[model samples]
Target: MKYKTICLIIFSLILLQGCVAIQSFPTVARAGDTVTLALGSSDQINIADTTVTYTPDGGVAVDLTSNVRSIFKLYPDRASPAWSFSAASGIPVTSGHSASVDIMVLDLPPGLVPGTGVIRVQNNAVYPIFSDIPSDADVAIEIVPGVGSPAAFAYSLFGNATAGNFTSLEAAPHFRIKPDFEPNAWYQAPTYAAAELTISGTLNAAALAATESQVTGQLRIIVDEMPTSLASQKQVSWARNGGDITINYLSPTGKMAYYETTVAVFFAASNYSFTATPNVSIRYFDIDGNVVTGPPVFIKSCTNATGCI
Candidate 1:
């Protein structure tokens, strides 16, 4: 009876040993998330070939690149540089039969588009027994937009007062003219005396005797005397055959100094009209020769009309 009891006890111990659970440390990680996997010492398990596959929940599986596998082996205690399958490190049992592996995901390059995805990790080993295991993890990425900076305004003048005609009295006076501009940008325009007559060199006979002196010798003048910060009104005038003709002035800044010159010719009547529309074009550009914006600048015959051309 005692011998029978001993046999039964030995059988019970063997059954208990078999029932002991093999602890599995399984983890799921996103493409950019870090993870760690460990096995107990008694398991005598070693990693032979490890790989991670990615897919959307309902999409097809795609193998993780060797670059990604190499990144996973960078952990000092988790991987052996000398032993690898593909890019994966072969985990070895050194002092302890138990071992742990660490994995990490890096940021994707700008070429990758934002998307939703999932990942699975697998381990194939011989010493411990080759097995494929998978765990589900989610991935989320976002794309940002690119924007350009605002451009600056440029200034220039086009008239008979260029460098070539600098010494000639026939040359028109220099006037600072601001182009029509957008908000928060800079501009300049001519300033003239209000209700006052300013004299310059007398008009030549060719100009004085012309049928329309106002149009033939007309000068488009500009000035920079104004503060460029305030809006003010000024008057412009010139003598034709020793008679005063009035022109209109509108500037944002209060007048600091006056700018004036005679048009080469004067019309017989103040109401004399032109065959083509008289208009000035204002163009804005940046330092790099790129056009920024533009607006039409009009000049009306103030001697007759009150509005702009």
Candidate 2:
């Protein structure tokens, strides 16, 4: 499930201190799509102690060092087309055994214009803080026109086998259907086309409350099957409740689904229903306010009559 069409660009540079490699995932990106730059060193050199910069085509070099951000008056650059490290993500890691940092470039609404750029990393040059120095390396990146809508829909369905255990049905107890457990609870139709679901941005409380009880919770989109902080879960709510529930991604973040990846959608929601079958419809919209991915749908059938639908 690799997005192979967008190749990984690795640029290596040897300096007197040590060599460094800069790798960009999905070398090609859209204007408003978040991109990741993986900087790895031949030896252990904490990227947090160094300086990072991004120079857009024909533009001045933008300082990407998170620590020096205050001195440089830096803001999230990529979102502005000028290019800066993302705010939501932290700087590269630092440790004796690790020599890599995954820099996340968050794209805000109406993000950077379609263009080219180079990301460079080097020493921070501060006194009393001698550390492993990394050589200079430039990773080229190409940003194409923004794809305002999601490209595909991918999701998994979870069902509660015993719905009668609780007074009301919430999303907390639902488990994604897998082969090990009650496999029959999870069913995918032959016509279904699975796509990754990108649930970014802040939660829509008003919209969520209107759909169900004032019940507001958060949703976390697990990518590459990695775990994130529980606090990072942004407020989330279903669009509606019934045997079927719809989750809409038309929030301000305007994130699109990434293609060719495996992702799991995890969330805690308010009470919905007590039906025998629960269906989830995840929808995305294009720039024209039209639905894309045809709204990938997944359904979980409750085996027990009193199970949470």
TM-score, structure 1 vs. true: 0.20
What lDDT, from 0 to 1, does candidate 1 have?
0.29
RMSD of each: 36.5, 22.2
lDDT tens digits by residue: candidate 2, 223-265: 3211111111222333333222333322233322221122234
Q: Write the per-residue lDDT of candidate 1 for residues 1-309, one digit (tens) a residue.
A: 674585344333322222111221112222333222221111111122445555544567666533231212112222323122211121121111112222223222222222445445444322212212233223332222332121111223473332322112111212212233222222243332231223223444444445544543554333322221223443334333332233334322334122221122233343432333233333333334444433433333321111112
TM-score each candidate.
0.20, 0.28
Error of 1 at 299 (Å): 98
Residue 164 of candidate 1: its Cα lDDT? 24
Cα shift from native, residue 193, model 1 (Å): 99
Task: Look at candidate 1 and tell me the lDDT of residue 238.
Answer: 35
Give each model's clash number: 22, 6
Q: What is the Å distance of residue 284 in model 1 from its true position? A: 93
- State the lDDT at 47 in candidate 2: 34
- Which runs of model 1 end up more than 4 angstroms from their true locations? 1-48, 69-96, 105-113, 126-309
